[model samples]
Target: MTRRAKRTRPATPQDEHAIPLQQQVNVPVLNLEWIKSRLNPATLERLMQVWGLVGRLTFPPSSSGKAREGSRRIPTADAHLLRKAGIIEEASSTITGGWIIPFSVVEEKTNGLRRRWIAWPRDKNRDDPYKANAPLLHISHYLPPAMAEAASCLDLKASFFRVSLPRETRHLFRCRVEDGTLVELTRHPVGYKAGPEILQIIITSAIAGVTTVVHRLWAAPPSVRIDVWIGNIRIAGSKSDATLWEAQVLRNADSCHATIGRTANRAPRSTPSWGCSLVTHTGRYP
Candidate 1:
């Protein structure tokens, strides 16, 4: 029979202690609240704006194009601390190189505006057809106080996001009261350099909720005459492709209606031919 090797005993403390260069490593759990508490209101406001625009929890890119990895990585430690504080979670490897937090986690209300958090995608190659950089929140065109009062009366959902185009683009687009109006209703400004594109994304997202309506009129005429008017003035001339696309959506919505209302603005009336001119310019539709 082969001789059995003698069993090695557990290392004694002396042996363990004798091992060269022993050091205690202290890893501190991150405190998310602590970080948040330290942020000044201005900083917090900026952070929220960035969050809403991006729609994600993310850090600025490191020199290496990825977050630093390894024991000494400061961001990793802060991320871990944030995780401990229940702010976000380490996403699965499929997402790679970032932590993810729910939109609701960092939501805050200020000056009666409800801010939401959003995440930006890591890969530049990824095609987010819906523009994700548009502002997520916006104030409706200054509604007449009476109309505002009427808006308050509608049996509307408790509160839903609203989108509006700037006064200029509204006229150039010849946005009638009826067509592709949902795109206009749901779209909002993306408070970033890429905001125009992102408006498309938010509109696309809102569309997913089939129960939601996208028309400018929140409720049907019987409930309230839509006291607001969307135009194509500054909207048509704007270089933003998003504004153009939104104009098309509005125009389409108008086409579907039997009687599309004309804008009170003179530009569209001055350029009656301009109503269908976008198709030629955008190369989209006629």
Candidate 2:
């Protein structure tokens, strides 16, 4: 059999975190009728508790029957397993949103029935123009020939909930619970403007250091780079260095009380030592 030469490809899209302007048109603004219709009591209560540990929920005085505009609830499923896992509870009224901003519920492929909160740019009375920042670590920048031989990727669990919101901005995210009780988010919510940026800063600062790899001993720590885009972090270095960095990340997560999902191990066993040579300007990767 004859073999054909590999085909070329186009540049990879880097805007995984971006939301185009046109897509913002349909996010339903929150109202009493819509929330009551779609809000799952169990899910809301659970989110409250989960966020509470990270100082995301706070009980303030009642709204005095005042109405909060541009707030809404997204669809969610109440699962017994979630409750059993101690991540969800049966009761508690909690609401969150901001001034006149259009809020939408985003369904993620990996999120199951849980809805993500998103503040739309097209909403009226907007104070800040939303901009999506590029991911700090570009594949080409972080994974040079030497480092690409081994790498580790770590995903933080409920990373957004782990970030506490500034006290001054908490009021902007206020909403009313079932009994008309007013509460505000003390921690960063997924949809707000600065959430992703804030998270990147926190994670980067926590794991910023170079350490010697166990497999190779050197007089000094080898060159290691860390690039964090949102909650996902990639650490590339010598094999031993990657292992050491992974341990450091776990420790940092513990200190911050952040739960980390074990999706990728220290490094996949079958990862090729091809040094990303197969990658081209078209952004194809081996």
Candidate 3:
């Protein structure tokens, strides 16, 4: 009699980047609420000034190529616990042979003022397990060259990681605080290789229905278009239409629990020299 072959489960895909675990194999998740509760009055005020609606604070890089020290200092007792939880790292001479990544700050010139803190993690970050693929922004040549008509541009607040990261991915955000305490970010931290890509994924997923609605409702005749680029959402249409669209977008943002920036305008208005054709969502040519 022919023996029946035994079926075996397929092997799981192995991740190329594996995080190094310390004595504590299982890292505890950071309690942001608790940490916030512990903040002193002065520190809290400092945080209010520096931090945006996003939990991230953007500090201009000093000549040394590091984030300028903010006025607020984390409580010493909380700092130790945070280190143990993998929220910060100790700047040790021995670990990684005393290698530290320097930071550079960039100012994004949108309608409002915004800055970003960038870190040099080399080409491949050992901590980042997933591949970083930024979502493509809407790029149609036919779209208006300038904000001639009414347009609303909204910036999402605290837009990074509305969803929780997979347990494996959480280990990637390890960094050293000023006190030399090693910490891992429970929430998605800025200045990581995969941060923007992951955040884009989250934002796209959340606003996918809204995108569909915008596409379906706005026809070619009306010349309404919605463009999402990273944290910015731009809606182009007539003054009234744009206002209504902005309201719809606000509702969508509320559902997604995303905060919108107060500033909304047609800041980059077009010059009189440019050719003026009936501007459609697809632009004049289309």
Candidate 4:
């Protein structure tokens, strides 16, 4: 049973500090709802007795990015986790003139076998308003430990389409698939302006959940972190810890078909950050 009152004193010598996270707690995917249920001020006051990082963990529920700029400095990892519960800005343009964006499915013939060639609609929304934005880690978020060696990549296949769309917005994503027939999207469309931000919400939740388990695992202290991008996630750490992190991610979400492959640990050759401003040119696929 959970205690209601806060613990006023420190853990006595008899307390088992060595107890592992797996043995202590199991947290599911964390979002605003999940955090509100237990991590609010009232509950956190009581939990401070248990976890004891209440001050660092506290953040404004609906605080915007601008609001956070003036607040006390929060550790990078914890700040990223707390952001999952904060209000996010929507980058999707307001629909006007009721016309669906035009699309075509012409896959290019280059690199036929190696790259994924899903039938993604070529969207013409470049001229349309797109405001998708998020707080992202620059490629050099931190320096790697010298002992930390290789890196690996995990691709969340067709990430945008995997997210289910609400009934009301489905019509806004209607597309023509080469044939004369029109199809309404039941899931988030790949080329849509709001798609990346929507996917970021869920991925952030998953990261918060997975990181809790990873940090408590025996292998965690010299931590091995798995960083995420729009669809591609990279797990970089010491060579020995790769399997440990991979296994935990798969266990966290069995349905996600995460493909593992060798990857360069260095930053991207193009501007060294994940936030890209260049609009995607029309391209063909399946």
Best by TM-score: 2
Tell me the spans in candidate 1 whose CA falls farther than 4 Å from its real position.
Answer: 1-87, 94-142, 147-222, 225-286
User: Candidates' TM-scores?
Assistant: 0.22, 0.47, 0.43, 0.42
Candidates 1 and 2, the one with greater TM-score: 2
Q: Residues 1-286, candidate 3, lDDT per residue (tens digit)? A: 1111133221111210121111121323323333234344443453334322222222224567543222223334444543564434443332121122423222223333222222233322443244434534464432335453665555543333233333343333334544655433444444555555444434532342233322333222245566555555556778677766566556554544443333323211110010111223434322
lDDT string, candidate 1, 104-176, tens digits: 1111122121212222222221322234333434324522333111111111110111233322222111111
Sort the candidates on lDDT, descending order.
3, 2, 4, 1
lDDT for residue 179 in candidate 1, whole number 0-100: 18
Q: Please report, in order, the local distance difference test score of every candidate based on alpha carbons.
A: 0.26, 0.37, 0.37, 0.33
Q: Name the candidate, 3 or 4, with the larger lDDT value.
A: 3
Query: Please, what are the lDDT tens digits per residue for candidate 2 over residues 1-286?
Result: 0111133221122221242111211111112122122224443353333323333222333477333443442112212222232222332343333432323332332212222333232221233433434344564564343335456665443444344444554554554333433445444555544445444443432333322111122112445556554544566666676667667666655544443334332312111100111111222235
In model 2, how large is the Cα lDDT of residue 56? 26
Poorly placed runs, candidate 4 (over 4 Å): 1-99, 105-131, 135-147, 176-182, 204-222, 255-286
- Most accurate candidate by lDDT: 3
Predicted structure 2: lDDT: 0.37
